[model samples]
Target: MKCKILPPKVLYHPVLPYKQLTSDNTHKLLFGLCRTCMNKISFKCKHIDDPTLNKHDKIHEIKRCKECKNIKNEKCIHSNEERVIVGTWSTIEIDKAIEKGYKLQKIYELEHFEKTSTDIFKLYVDTFMKYKQEASGCKCDPKYCKPDCENDKECKTKIQYIIDNAAYNLDIDKVKHNSGLRFIAKICLNNLWGHFGMRDNFTQKEYCFTLEHITKIVFNEKYKDISTMILDENIVLTEYKEKEEYSKPNPSVNVYIALFTTAHARLKLYELLDILQERVLYMDTDSCIYNDDGSEACKK
Candidate 1:
């Protein structure tokens, strides 16, 4: 099916504004407030401002981060630092909380987790919109007109040579008839969404026989999450997770894209349900089951 709707280029942070929803304010927000907490746990160093501290080599540890603990300070520096686990909330939530007279204490501890105003998906939207316009016709530019263009005959015939030849003009009829083509197209669509939302870190396994190899992995300050299993006296299997900085994040994994894709899908689904009303018996992400009362409902 052809889709013309596109989601916003920028979006608020994924977290909901409130924890729970009630009948008094069911429609206060677009979606219901998240019932569960999505707090991200992170470690900060006390000597972050210290000029002598190796800021680049800060390692997160369980009780006390390794970098600050090793330093011989006059006082227990780590104890004085506000080592806090803060919840990442959307700007709307923060503002609402403040408006409701909830005093935000320790405001200095807050850090910007993500950019609120960035054209991160601008290139992606521009590329797709360009193709859409070319496959149709530019409102001002007539030289690149296509057969599917809603422009005049003069403009349509201008680019008649590449009407069906261009890569943008996909043969939907061929794909619909051919099972292989349909499968490939479906997989490609799903892969695009999944690829963008791919997880960055995964626990990796390492098998070592030497004490040096085992010690190197076990005592590495960079890897905060580590576990080891002694298969035998000579064999040791180590599973460890690399810190965010050390981890290789997927270049294309943008949460904004994935969120928009799903958001648009949900909106489309809701549109259909609104039309069907009580007829909608069941529905899923990509499938719908509604009662057809021998009318234009099914035809539509």
Candidate 2:
């Protein structure tokens, strides 16, 4: 037999066409689609320790983050602890939410009880990540005592684990958190919400050169932390009464105002359209259109 190749007079895939993505198929779409876009940068990054940031670096161009395997170099990218996602839903989905015993409520940016200088972002994330005992040098292994171990929750090893975790507090010397944990805590405390308040989107668009700059200048001069070297600062709410307008606005107390304000604005837009009260077909974190006109959604 001679080698040969023949072109089909008519050619097409014989496989069954996939399900048409509709308001009812969100779960399937999420599972089937690759979320490569998640890695692309849409916002800026801010530094936690350096209040002396540059205004020019604020509006830098978009690039993919380190989390994206496809990104090149990836060295200049900055990552953060928490992010705010603003979403929208179609009217039918809004109706479904009511059928499922849910109603949208006003979402507020997180406010903590700690003073703005306290780095609450770090405090909570550290506690929540269960990093307390890992850096204590106690040499205890979690595999030795899982939470669901045969021993009652009061085993001696577990007791030692508890004591080991309680040995250090960031606020005190004797009681300590793991040193590595503390390092992570420091990053989160400083950068999490601060990223939101920044004015530049090049990396993190913090409100640079504003009253925050003044606060850092003042606090770094007056403060003393024997255990930590935080560049403690103020978030003044008093009106800027200066004869000259500030080069940038003064910061609200340690606020990621951009983060929360953007979210609130999204909610306000959703409400203005009365999206929930009407018949909607879908919902997405930021956008919900009546139809998906993409190739997959249009597949026969």
Candidate 3:
């Protein structure tokens, strides 16, 4: 969406203060957090080039092999367009944990772990709690959060009331259970980082290309080096190249910051899932599929 220059009497600072995130630091921080205390972990890959050849080359990334362990550090050194193979594990329940389960352990192990801040999602409950705190006067900035609850009086009052009265927050502080706040927080979390929507100021060609090609560019730049995945259809590179009307770089829409938030959100999901001791099957950016009876205890 494009911002219009309103006459000065309208809302000042309608947008939140922007924060910057360096890609390298974010990669290390997020991967580090996800690697701690993982149980039932395993890894399996058919091929690796060699670990000692290149420090930045992750082609030889191997986790369980003692000889391959030295070069796994590159997994945390991502560029703006680098792809990371993030490994996640499920903390199974007592019944599932004793099933004599066996799995491999060839993961590209993490280098370190770091503490997360309030601006991130630590499951729905923590996000709801943070939202409540923000509504009641906690920090609200792009560095850690995007909710406008701190600024809107009505929204603030409503969330605080929910926090004060809700039993879900009292249920040993788990987000896997049910509550109105958790429901709303889950919705907010799912849609927190929408696509970098198009700007209205673009010409027709630029608009079309932005929608059709920008995602392709980023995806290809990240995955082009990895040979294991098959590229069935070649992307037509020059299909849309129009002479463009140049606009100044908008500092607020930096992709790196968006990527950083997404990484933390991912860590938040893993943290929430592993803590709840559920059988985590799979996870996308905003969703996870785990073994549950579809009750309040199963939802995350």
Each prediction's Cα lDDT score? 0.50, 0.36, 0.37
What tens-digit string does per-residue lDDT give for candidate 1 at 161-202? Answer: 344555454322211123344455456557768988788897
State which candidate has the highest lDDT: 1
lDDT of 3 by residue, 202-296 (tens): 32221223435645543443232211222235422222322234444444353433555655555566565654454667666578777777766
| Alpha-carbon RMSD, each predicted model | 19.5, 25.2, 20.7
Better of 1 and 3 by TM-score: 1
Consecutive 10-residue window with the lowest summed lDDT within model 1: 1-10
* Residue-wise C-alpha lDDT for candidate 2, range 1-300, written one tens digit per residue: 111111111212110111223322332322111122222322233322244545444223112223333342233223221111223433333343344333344333433445444353555656633444333323335446443332443444544565555633322222232466656755665565566576521211123245665455345432332122223353332212222222335444334444444445445444423433233355454565444344333332
lDDT for 186 in candidate 3 is 52
Candidate achieving higher lDDT, 1 or 3: 1
Q: Best-fitting candidate, measured by TM-score?
A: 1
Using lDDT as the measure, name the better of candidate 2 and candidate 3: 3
Ranked by lDDT, the better of candidates 1 and 2 is 1
